[model samples]
Target: MATDGPNLASTYEYVIVGGGIGGITLAARLHARLPEASILVLEAGSDPSTHELATSASTVSAVRSNADLTWQLPIEPCKGLGNRSSIAQVGKGLSGSGAVNSAAWTRGPACDYDLWAHSVGDQGWSYESLLPYFKATECVRGMKINEDHHGYEGLIHVVPVKANWAKRTYPLRKAVQEAWAQSGVDYIEDGNAGDPLGLTELVEAWDEGKRQLPSKSFDLEGVDIVTDTLVHRVTFTQDQGHEPRAKGVELISGQHINATKEVIVSAGVYHTPKILILSGIGDPQTLVAHSIPLVHGNPEVGNNLRDHLSVALTWKLKHPEIGLALGSPLLTDPSYANGAPLDFIQFGRVPTNLHTEMLLTSKEDKALVLRPKACHTESILLYTYMGPHMSGVNVPMDGTYITTVTANLAPTSRGHVSIHSKDPQQPPKIDVNANDTEVDRHILREGLRNISKVLHETPSGQSFIDSQVPPEGYPVLLPDSKDEAYDVRIRDFGFTLDHPMGTAAMGKVVDASCRVIGVNGLRVVDASVFPVPIAAHIQVAVYALAARAADLIAKEQ
Candidate 1:
């Protein structure tokens, strides 16, 4: 299945940059809507041959495997994280991050979409307008016959947990539900059904125990896909010095692929803004400093960078089964257990009553929720995901740690993404400035405290936990609490969710229609255009946005 050459070397009606969820979803939608139009996707990295790179926790692990799917570019050092420069993770192959993400596809509360639409002044962007497209991307498999929020037929597969698995995670969840009820927050059957409150089982993207890819499901035969191609810059033609009309895209290899009607930038938050700045459509001051000629003076291009900061809290469990290792040879061995882990479970919650949830847990559970800030800030929990197995931690030879991680899904602090140089090959400067906001820091602290409470509530609780973080009870932030020092202790250990968004904000840099303000034949359809980070995981929202963009682009064409 080696691709002989660029799928469509020199000509295409549409050229999409970045083949991740955003790009692939649009590619599929375009083929379904416009069968005759030729589409080309340019990815900078190589195709990942194995799912390991796609599923690994470390960003570098994803890029290491596929030479054709990942190309390491030198990023100018970031100022937020002590002036140390690091490489940013971007997809270079067909499935993009869809191949590597944790695969939790949760649609954030509908309120987020409504707010986004209002901010952008687009009537077509409300939750109602976007729901159909959400349905279009999902194929909910094996659900209750009467499940209304689930989809019947769609390209991507949605797999819920099996009966036994759901039962196992139920106790932990039930404890939390009981706690939330005491706090006066009612539970809902489905989080995606308009209101997201209380405990809910997350919907994952999987088919027969493997990750789902949009290319296979979305494109039965119509779309032309290209991997190993990087879009260096967007080519444009100006008319009367008004809005610039998109012509095509220039590849990293210097090949120019034409976009007959329009070129949509579906790269995710990091690369979308990078591409914009490289194309000369960003903050003129930053662009000028990088020595790049300004194409459009949109100062908001890379500002308002926001992401959910995540930290892992771990504990040693009483039962070894609770911390069974999926990657262990006994479980993952081809001949043993059919390559299934002894125990792998996930339970989700939409924090409606944050205060009471924190108060219910023991001090040890609080540590699991939010690690003492003075301890490892990079991770928040001390998880006993696996222990004392024949294989140590079941980790690969690489530097990846096979432990559980939890991120504060909503962060109040905002950051920025700016261009370091005019060169597309050069990575953009990413300044998350994480935890700078006291509100975000306090929220994370509260969230950790709540999770810790859940850990100590039942047999499902501390039984599987190996150790408690902070070696002390949960950190307290209340005004009357005598432990004022705990507040300072919690702030020191905050981490980044690695989920950045809001650059090239919807109403500010781009209109509600996703069209770049003051520019024509150009639009940003990636996560960058999200005015604010949605309350749930970002992957689903990115796909939904791409689907919506395809509709807008097709109508105009």
Candidate 2:
């Protein structure tokens, strides 16, 4: 129920801030593990299952501009993007970003999680340790699930794109596959098998033609959910012989709810660290500047922020009937060949020659170089116009355009999320130093060129392309341009794919179990705790992390 004013219950065994995927999942798991424990979940937004803008799968468009469903938080003017500022579309309701995001379910390469485990000095954070949780969280449907690699009974249902799901045949599907094959990328049988290399059919968190938001899928029966309650800061109790403990959370209404055992912060990438800093658990200088007393001095709380930067290339289709639009019947039918539409995604590394040149020439770029064994770029085929509307480019609404969204999955340019004011309601200042390093620009340039080659140079891809509609001043073909021209074009068109992570980093701010380093009874379980950004869409990782976190918390209890 919606809890407002000062009448909130004073005590609970656990208090979770932000009822997003992480919070809701943790609460459900906690309830399952500790049947009698009283759990409280405070959400800043309304419950997603009942919210008007959150009910429909097509609400992805409305959620971006709807203030009631999203934070619509703006970032500081990024110097890398020609001093341009952009709004971060973060879901505000119980389901969080999962409710509004394109339900593409992707688990990145095994090495990505292995690297995280090594970086954090925790074997529990390794891929093998997290695999069970990953399997347990997904109930594979429609697609062929490798029995050894997938679970039969899970909370979220994963649906693969079937031919019947297409309103009409994606005339270019075969051509695109042929193009990727021509470009030397192999077809991956399963993208969720910890090896997301080459071309693969897109998997989504869908069931019966509807998006399964975590708030609706997971069971939160035993948890006391308090909606429309903004947690101002975490309340702490310091004992002379022990580390400071999180006693409870103070609401924006000045009401305090006690957490007898522990408090967990799952307020997402930006707000997670923002709450920590507001609670005096961040950099001492920041707390002092806000005239807030310091509880713990963790300078890394709001630092080391990272996100996937994407660039779009749109092409006019020769046949409009072959393309899928937003309201196509093929998209909303579960009985369709697969369950969803628009499959086909490719993950590849930038050319070795460019990698070598960057390593030899620039120190900054050298640090940002894509590891030879790692996949640094993701190219996904879309049957509809997919460029960011904020880019000032008019996307064709006549349904004759197809776009290729290429993203720098492994970006080296680190940014941060810092609080601008002491008010908890004020959004954090986000600075995702996108395209700052030469390596990022170089990767995007190569990625754009690679996709262009697949769609234009290859025989099958070229057969379907009627014409191209590049942004103003952008080169007709990226590969033909000089490095300077490519860099300018990248800076002009680059935008966030909304996969942000590493603000309250694991190795730095929290432990392997996601417990905050210098505090007792306070842990962070969300995207903010990731040591680095994963190569895949983050929702899958968040599910695995939350499941693991729930197990860890249960063991400790």
Best by lDDT: 2
Best by TM-score: 2
lDDT of 1: 0.59
Q: Candidate 1 residues 1-557, lDDT tens each?
A: 22525656577788778777788788778777888888766666555645454543233333444555543434444343334444444455666667655566667666567666766667577778888878877877766523555566877777554322533232233433454445444545565565554544455665555556565556636556666666788888887846787888887777788887777887777788888888888888887787877778888888888776654443444434323344533334332221122122222343334563355344322322332211111112222232222112233322122243445554555677876667677766777766554444555555555555545543444434434433244543232333234344334433454456788888788888788787666778778888866766678888889888888878877
Q: What is the C-alpha lDDT profile of model 2 across 295-328, one tens digit per residue? A: 9998898898889998777788887766766555
TM-scores, all models, native as reference = 0.78, 0.94
Query: Model 2, stretches more than 4 Å misplaced?
Result: 1-7, 163-168, 325-341, 353-373, 387-392
Residue 419, candidate 1: Cα error in Å is: 2.0
Clashing pairs in 2: 162-337, 162-338, 164-337, 165-337
Candidate 1 regions exceeding 4 Å error are 1-9, 49-90, 162-188, 325-383, 386-406, 456-467, 471-492
Whole-model Cα lDDT per candidate?
0.59, 0.81
